[model samples]
Target chain A: MTKIYELMPDIQGEEMLILQNLCRDYSEEKLRNFATIYRTRRKDPLLILVLTLVGLAGFAGIHRILLNQIGMGILYFFTGGLCLIGTIVDAVNYQQLTLQFNRRLAMEVHQLLNREV
Target chain B: MWCLLNTFFACVLRTFSKKTFLSLPCKDFKSDDGMKSGIVRFFVHNFEAWFWLTSLILLAFMPPESTQTTFCVWHLLGFESCLGCGLGHSISSAFHGHWITSFKFHPLGLVAIAILTIRIVSVFNQNYTFERLNKKFTHDKNL
Candidate 1:
């Protein structure tokens, strides 16, 4: 499945083989079986920025939202007003959190690329 | 309600960022379906994305001028001052020829300004190998 950006002919030809190698034999049944499509998940830079903005505003939960970790994002949102504990915790572990979300998103995208359309 | 908003924003992220790992996508994704390999690359790229975002957050808190005294965003955020306090003042001192003041504020501030300035210039000159440099640092850190 061609990602939207690579649909153009010239660009398509240039990186075709490389892209083909990247997206391989995962069957449609396997993809649907996985529950959430692993490859479709993406970390929006804007969301990351907003999350970081919230982080700067001493709201670590914002990072959770960017990761689609809704439960935690809210916990932090209300709790954020109370202290810096969450923010500090986030700052320390942000790398892990961001990585986790990206992994989830990557799986989803892989599924999308598998779609028949 | 706020929780719903958070979910909405997360959806926005899902819609906009197509490939997730620094914008890479499987265009020619035919039968081979390298899910495992793609994940490895995703993790590798995530490190970078995290670093860049963290750096951005760090810079975002750099107190602004003119209203530096009156408008303190960090304070608004409910945190104490950062380690590199008075950095802006130190930078100003460096330009104003106040060496003592610059060092007094933050000894490393001027050096940071210098290195970053040099790198920015190198980027403009197209001599900057950002990926290679990051790899070197990543290696050094591991070592």
Candidate 2:
């Protein structure tokens, strides 16, 4: 299997390091499978940023829901993105939000792969 | 009960001061070890429920209709409309059993209340599947 970082060179910084650490114990086949699954499921921070910008028009919390924060998404939708203040904050921090969501995804995927392995 | 209340406030103080939820420095407290962990766990696990319940309580106290004294940043900034204009009024009306008016004000009020109730009640059980699903989509600061 490809080295974790080389296989997913696009993911860098903390998330990359995190995935690498989680996969350290994985067998080669398990790592390849994880890379494949994670690549498909990973959210694009850019997409979340675009969606947050969409809040200026309407549909305030779609990105939160995409990140699986259903309650927060609903709160944002009902509160008009917490009167748009929260939306602006979210827009500014979309990368962090994406990273947070992706980290959780990585953890879950890792656990599932472990089970399978 | 008193201890629980104190722990709740401790959690709140940490949240405001640190600008994070579930990132409490429980170990720094001088409280007894077992109780500290219990309180921290309680705060960490029930953070969302407390958040929604607090919001619900606050909204309940707000005047259903915006008064002259009410301040709206949207109106202040000269925006014609905003996504959450009538939501507060909607929530208040819904709480008072004014379903039609609540929906007319904001269609999401009842749905929000229902969701919050579900969330508040779900804290008692550890639904591992749902937890896993939720974890996949949400970030835990303490994690």
Candidate 2 CAPRI category: acceptable
* Best-performing candidate as measured by lDDT: 2
Instruction: Give the residue spans of candidate 1 off by over 4 A.
Output: A1-41, A44-50, A56-60, A115-117, B1-143
DockQ values, each candidate: 0.03, 0.28
Model 1 Cα lDDT, one tens digit per residue, B98-125? 6887788666556645543543343323
lDDT of 2: 0.66
Winning model by DockQ = 2
TM-score of each: 0.30, 0.59
Question: How many clashing pairs per prediction, in order?
Answer: 19, 0
